[model samples]
Target: SAIYLWRFGSIKSRILTVCQHFFFISFRARPLVQTFTSWKAPIIWEEMFDSILYDQGHTDKNSSVALTVFAVGRYLDAYLKTFLTSAEQHFMLGLPVTYYVFTDSPEKVPNITLASRRNINIVQVEKHTRWQDISMMRMRTISETIESEIRHKFHYVFCFDVDQEFKGRFGSEALGDSVALLHAHYYKLPKAQFTYDRNPKSKAFMETGDFYYHAAIFGGLWQNVKHLVDACYLGIIEDKLNNVEALWHDESHLNKYFWIHKPSKLLSPEYCWDQSIWDKRDILITRLVWAPKHYETLRSG
Candidate 1:
C-alpha cells in the first residue's frame, strides 16, 4: 500500500509539473527578449507602450507627420493602391499626415479618401533598371528632400516600402529621435546567422552587429532621419567608387549604420512582419505585413 501511494504521488507530481511548464510557456517571453538595448533605448513591442499616452502627447503638440514611400517603376502599379488605401485606414490616425510619395508614375497614384489634415505630394523620380539601384538611391533622395522640404514642414517622419500594408495602428508610439526596425526574418535567429555585409571591400561590411534593421522601414525625428540617410548615401557613394556593392544593397548598409551609430529606439519585428515567411508565436500584433512578392516579375521589369 505504501509503495503504491508513493508511485501514484510521483505520477501526480510529474503531471502537475508538466502542466505548470506548459502554462508558463504560453506567457513567458520565449527564447528571451532583448526589450532594451545596452545603451537603454527601449525596444518597442506589444504591451510595452500605451497608445493613449503617446497619442495625447502628440495631440497636445499638434504634431504633423511625413511618410515617405517609393514606388518607382513596376512597384508603382502593383503596390501603390493597397499601400495608400491601407495607410489611409490605419496609419497615424487623428494626426496630420503628409505623404511624400516618390514614383515614376504620378498618374497612377491612387485617390485615397484620407481623413482631415491628410494630403499627398507626388514627387517624380527616375526608375532604375536594376532593383538594387532602386533601393540604394532612396537614401540620397530622402536626404535631399529633408534638406529642401521636410525639415520645416513636419515634426516627425517615417520611411516605408510601398510593397506593404498597414494592418494595425502605426501610431505615435514609434516617434523617436531615431528609430530602426528589427528585421522580421532575422530577429529570432542567432547573430551568427545575420546577413551583415561581410565583404571587406564594401563600406557596409561589419565584423560584429547588435541588430539587423530592415531597410524597408526606418525613420525618426526629421533631422536625425536626414542624418542617417546622408551618412548612408555617402557610404553607398564610397562603395561605388571602390567598385563594390554591399551584398543586400541598402539593407546591408542600414544594418551597418545601426551597428555603428545605434538607433535611439528599435521597433520589434511585430512592426515589420512578413506573413509568408514567419510563424513566430511572439508577434501579438502585426502593424505592417509584407504584401505578396513577385520578385522575379518585379526584377524582370
Candidate 2:
C-alpha cells in the first residue's frame, strides 16, 4: 500500500519513492560489495598442504612438516639469492617439506618446484622506504605471514627472515613443538635490561641471568608459531589503538607476549648463529651470512 501510494501520489510521496528505490538498490548490491571486500591474494592452503605432503614423499596417511619464510618487497638481492640457495638445499634434500615463501616479488624469484612463493595476503602494509620503516614492517609482516601459514594444514611451520642463509639442517628434529631462537652472543643483554613498562597490563618480572627471553630473531614450530603470531598481533593491535610504538618494532611485542605467555620450546643459538661471532661454539651453524666481508673465514656450519 505504501509503495503504491508513493508511486502514484504527491511530491512528498514521489521523493520518498526515489529514496526507497535507491535504498533497495544499495541493499541488493551489498552482497557484491562484500564479495569484493573479501577478495585477497590467491591462497589455497589445503591444496598447498597436499602438494607439500606429496612432494615430500609422505604417504596419503602420513603427516607433513612445512617451512614458511616471509620475503617481500626489495630485500637485498644478495640475501635473497643466498637464502633461496641455503633453504632449498637444507629442507628440500630428504624431508617431506613444503617451503612457502610469502613474498611480494614472487615472479622475480625463480619459482622452484619443491618450494614456491605464496601471495602476500596482508593488506595496507606500507613498503619499507627507510631503515626504520623496514624494521617496523618486518615485525608486522612476520606476524601476518606466520598467521597465514598457521591457517594451512601443516604439522609445523618455520618463519625466517630472508636475509639469513641456512647452512645446517633445519629439519623436524630441531624444532619439535618448541620455538628455536638464534642466540646472538655479540648483542647479548642481561634479562634485567629486557624488563620494561611497555606492557602496562602485565607485571614486570625477571629472574637471575634468565637469558632465554633475550632475542626474537627466528622462532617456529606449528603450534608455537601460531601461538606467538597470535600473541604478537594481539599486542600490536592494542599498541596501535593506544598510539604506542614498540621500541623493537614487532620484535618488542613478540618479546613482551612470549615473556609472559612462555614458548613451548626455546632452541639454542647454535641453530641460528650470526657469522660475525667467531668465539662462540657448539651445535651446527646452519645459517651463514656475510654481515662482514672480512669475516669470510668463519665456517658456514
Candidate 3:
C-alpha cells in the first residue's frame, strides 16, 4: 500500500514538474521575444532603405530628372513642399531638375528651394472650366498648358496630382531612360482601369491575358508623354465619335497607348504606394515618403 502511494505521488510530482517547466520557459521568453521584435524593426528598415538607395545608384544625375505638378486652389502648399522635398533629396544632389507648377493659384505656393537654388517655376493656367469638368476640359487644359508652357523641354515630367507625395528617386537609375509608369490598384480591372493585361507570349491565364502596363502617376519621361498626349488626343477624338467618355479622362487614354505600345517600364510599386496599397507593417520598413500628413517619423530621438 505504501509503495503504491509513493508511486502515485511520484507521477503526480513529475506532471507538476513538466507543467512548471513549460510555464517558466514561456515566462522567460516573453520579454526576450518582445525585445527581439523591437530591435528587428530598425534593422529591417535600414536594410530595405539600403536596398533602395543601392538600386537607385545614389547619384544626382542618376536620380530623377525633373518634377512637374498640376495643382489647384488651396492645395499648392502641401504639393509644393512635397515637390521641394523630393528635389532636395534626389535632384539637388546633381540632377538638373525643375518643379513646374501649373495652376491659377501659383502665387499662393510657398517658395521653398533646394540648397538656395531656385527650384520652382509657377505657370499660371486659366481656370476656365469648373472642377467638375475634370474628365475632359481639365485634361485639355493640362495638355495645352504643357504644350504652351513646358515646350517639352524637360527630360522627365511628372504630371503629379496635387495630392500625392513622391517617395522614391524619380531619376534615370530607378527606371533608366525608358518611360516609367506607376501600377495603379485598378490595373487589373477593365472598366475601371485603362492599361492592358494580356501577355502575347503566355498561355496561362489566356482569358485574362498577360498584363501590360497601362499608366503611371508621379513619373514618366517627357518624350513619351509628348507621344502619349498626341495619342490621347487621337483616342479622345475617337471616343467622342463613339460617344464613350473615358473613366479617368486623359489618364485612361495614356494607359491604353502605353499598353499597346509598351513604351514604358513598370516602376516598383513601393515608389508611389498610397496608404491603401499596403498595410501598416509593410509600410513600416519602407522608405515610403508622401504628403497630406497621414504618416510621420515613427521613431523619435
Predicted model with the maximum lDDT: 1
Lowest lDDT block of 10, candidate 3: 1-10
lDDT of 2 by residue, 26-51 (tens): 21222221111111111111111122
Q: TM-scores, in order shown?
A: 0.86, 0.59, 0.58
Where is model 2 poorest over a 10-residue stretch in terms of lDDT? 35-44
**Residue 228 displacement (Å), model 1:** 0.7
Candidates in descending lDDT order: 1, 2, 3
Question: Number of backbone collisions per candidate, in order?
Answer: 0, 4, 14
Q: For residues 1-301, what per-residue lDDT tens digits would candidate 3 score against the true structure?
A: 0100000011113222332111111212222111111111110111122233333342422333455666654455445566566656654345556677777776677767465433677777665443224434445654665577555455455555556555544443343223434453543346433333233221111123223333335344555555555666666666666655555556555555644545323443444555665444323222234455522321221
lDDT, candidate 1, at 138: 91
Give the Å shift of residue 143 in candidate 1. Answer: 1.0
Candidate rank order under TM-score:
1, 2, 3
lDDT of model 2 at position 185:
55
Backbone clash pairs for candidate 1 read: none
Candidate 1 similarity to native, TM-score: 0.86
Candidate 3 local distance difference test against the native: 0.44
Tell me the spans in candidate 1 whose CA falls farther than 4 Å from its real position: 1-32, 294-301
